[model samples]
Target chain A: MKKSFHLFYIFIVSISIVVLPSCTKQKGCTDNTATNYDSEAEEDDGSCTYNAETDVEIHFSSMVGTESLVYNQEYTINGRKVKFTRAQFYVSEIHLHQADGDLVHLEDKYLLVHGEEHAYSIGKVASEHYHGISFSVGLDSAANHSDPSTYAADHALSSLDPNYTHWNWNSGYVFIRLEGYVDTTAAANGDADFGFFYHVGFDEFKRDIDLDISQDLVGSTAEIGLEIDFAKFFLGVDMRTENSTHSMDNMMLAEKIADNADDAISAE
Target chain B: MLTMQFQLSKNINRLTNAGVIPAFVSFFLLLSSCGKDELISDTAYNLEIPKGFPAMDIPLDNQLTVQRVALGKKLFFDNILSRDSSVSCASCHLPEYGFSDPEQFSKGVEGRSGFRQSMTLTNVAYNTLFFWDGGATSLELQLLAPIENPGEMDMNMPELIERLSNNHEYPSLFREAYDREIDPFTITRALAAYERTLISGNSRYDKYMYHEKNDALTESEKRGLEVFNSSRTNCSQCHSGFNFTSFGFENNGLYEYFADSGRARVTTLHSDVGLFKIPTLRNIGVTAPYMHDGSLTTLEQVIEHYQAGGKLHENKSPLITGFQLTTQEKTDLLNFLNSLTDYEFISQTAE
Candidate 1:
């Protein structure tokens, strides 16, 4: 009787291990094709086809005719003139919002773009015909403070060039960098106005800008264009003569640039 | 009797032929039903909450319960999550020093050193954002960072799930904390739920702000509040609100060449070059060596740094140009900053 009891226990345990796993296995491996965890909770009726072709592009705009460039053209820096000739910034957290409010946010939302060009694109998004596109003008809250090495990726924008965006190091990416030559022809001071740059990131208060592309798109694919008005940047400030004396070392103009978020964008 | 015995034997043989024994099948069915029936509750697990704190903002997707918090606490302290099982979250952030590592920068797995100081978790529940740069908007999302960070715990998400799922206590704990399942999201949420309960609202500054208690703070501290609120100091412009931080990034005149562009790196803008997020002043006395870069050593030096309006001038904030403060005012401000410290937070234990 004792021998039979031992066999009985072993048999039951073994059967439980084998049969139970197979029973659960019938639910199948949750492939990457399944919608996000949030959708699964809603018991996604499979009505929304997970199979879709998607493409995304990030655009940049630079000053049109201003060749030599101007610094603090918008404000004074270190009691001198400043100009912004070069600028590169980041746009991240690209999320596709469905008509039902369900969102498909990409794991890697980091995109590095320069104003000298038009846009950059993340190829073949999951939902091409997204209801609306929501993205941050800068890094999202999570990635902003995370360690740089933790964000390692083979094809990440930071990986492409370490100097441009400061990747694989401590702190987050420089969301935007503006650089250019200062117009020093009319300067009263003999300060050289060449090689001026405006580097902005975590400081600027307007780090989080939400663009509602819902109105821009007609279907799954939409060309979300943002016309950066370079003229509006230097409205109240003068960079030409100021560049002779002022430079990046003087953060006053940088603060003005940091505070100058309202004057930066428009719908092209 | 012969007919009954023959029927029973025949039935048993029939079951055996179908790849199951009668008793084995019966036990498996019973156990499976019991496992399914042992569904975890969706509500947040119970953790001890101190008085004078607000209800934590836990994500709906990840509810906290007592068992889940326990599991999260264990995971939080477990060095097994590291690549070499050497360091854990608590390694840099100890419970004793208000969760901040004593070292300015922590040593990570494989004896690698981190770049920044380990921030304290005092009154972190009310934080508008996490990390010095405000990178993670939610706690749930923030939990994934340190675990996977190459300089930190250095563990992969898949391996973490596998290890936890195999543990005897975790399967049911996962089922209890999350309904009947174990996955990455559930684990992240549970851990986040546990962290959200860390509140530091009982500081002397909090009492003075809310009540008219005259003795809540010293006279020097009160004078410090005056200087901090005064225009000459201009501290309140960025450090405003009850949280004592505007939670926005600023240049703070830390560097000129932009070794770290700070928030500008995330936004990719030229104007944000030297800026960094404004860290909260709650428990400021204990959590420093100050600034995003940990450049200043003491509160006096920090105040002095601000008094001098910082070193870098190009694109420096207009608010940061020298305050020319009197020695008395400087002393007052430092006292006020020290008053923000809350000692009770580090003492609390998991109930």
Candidate 2:
């Protein structure tokens, strides 16, 4: 009897040990301990202050013109001086990768740069000094079909506006909107009205290009001044040789420029 | 004293042989009850495959089990998907009318009409593209459009995630649907998974094709297919294939001025002026009024418009060089289009 009682006691003890831990797991005991420990330490140390700020500036040439054939530039296209009317594009999801390996992610990533809408501007960073800025040249997939109602309310995230960008009930957005009639309808003559209309976005063909800039946002002010060259938008492609009625249907030139972001003359 | 001692000894022996007796039994029963509870909970969402339909394009990322589909169905029908609790996906796309609205445009959070017509959700899985302009290439992306659209559900991703996470029921459901963490992608994928099952391939026309049921088509329907494929119609060029869409946008000569630039608006090409995607004619009988703008109320009007070679011609489709079709052909073509209606699709349920 004595031996049997000893065995029973041992069995109960083993079961208790096993079942107790399971009970602790169900109660989420570990999570509570970890969080409490962290909070208590934080209270004692008075550290982890988010003291960081940075200014970002984006510059473009002509301040106008849609795709190619600069409208109102001092220089002439083929021979005739052209004047640009309007130019606008979307820049969104500004993510800053820091040297220390921390990321300073910006909210309201969408920024519309329209000559009429004033030079594009967005600022504020709470993380450590950033190393460099990485952003999409056009709208991200999620923001493309974003609801305008929510977008207007959350302007910090989405720069989409119906009146300005035309988030039609159908297509998400016109990534780059350049509108104005060409001077003449001839591909060969310099005097003909010719302009480029490149609405490059989520088609099956367009590639996603990551703009790599060797910028150091470390010590000083973590600000980045980006310059987009208007001159190189129209490269070897002869604008004067084209007529007004030509199709900007093919986006090979736009793709070339987007890919040629570095080669384009920078205007800061 | 001797008798009492013997009884006590007998009780001790029983207890020892039973291995802690009551306590052990209690523990085993507890474990068994837990297992039994799991079995009861495992009642499959009871998914019913539509007749004559192939296996759906179930997303690799979000597979549709019964529980997930049931959860998705509730969420789709629930007003909680909206920010202010004003709308659901079913608000715009109802289940009865082939998952399309009776009105041309649907009202949003603030009773505002969306700029475009509510698209039909029939056989949406077969769609290679979505929306009138084919903006979203996948069902995964299409879920975001209505949820985030101001004139639709009007919910942001963060707020949406918070709302779902906050709900006691949804968190558990999300945990079950995606064995991982809960986020926008999982939620969107689940919704997409439910929608992918909404195939409209069980229509009368489908029966005729797959089941060799000649009676599925009336004489008018047979004659209509003839006119539809004829040079005078040029309809089959775009509305071809089993799913009934070539996935090409054409300038149906809707307008000369560019208010709605259609594909041109997206591509910035002058040649694409007034061009819009050619929508599937499947279930056309129920999902009307029609067209991207929902301008045409009946199939007959749609046929007549095409018969008249459309209104504008600034950048009309090269294929639409005005074919001369008799009134009878137009009537016959409309009949064929009506036969494509899939009433059973509108009424399908996840059993």
TM per model?
Answer: 0.53, 0.57
Residues B1-351, candidate 2: write the lDDT tens digits: 333334434444555556666556655554565454243343444445555545666655556677667677777888888878998889888887788898988988988787677888877877766787676657766777788788788877667877888888888887776654556666776787678667777777777777899998988878888888877778888788776877678888765575666777556667877878787788888888887788788877777677677766777876675677677767778788888887777775433
Which whole-number lDDT from 0 to 100 does residue A126 have in model 2? 46
Interface RMSD of 2: 13.9
Error of 1 at A264 (Å): 35
Tell me model 2's lDDT, rounded to 2 decimals: 0.62
Taking the tens digit of each residue's C-alpha lDDT, what string does model 1 give over B130-197? 77656565666567568768888877665776787887878887776667455556667667766766
Model 1: number of clashes? 91
Error of 2 at B123 (Å): 1.3
Model 2 regions more than 4 Å off: A1-268, B1-56, B312-314, B323-328, B348-351
What DockQ do you compute for every candidate structure? 0.05, 0.07
Per prediction, fnat is 0.06, 0.09
- Give the CAPRI class of candidate 2: incorrect
Where does the lowest 10-residue lDDT sum fall in candidate 2 chain A? A24-33
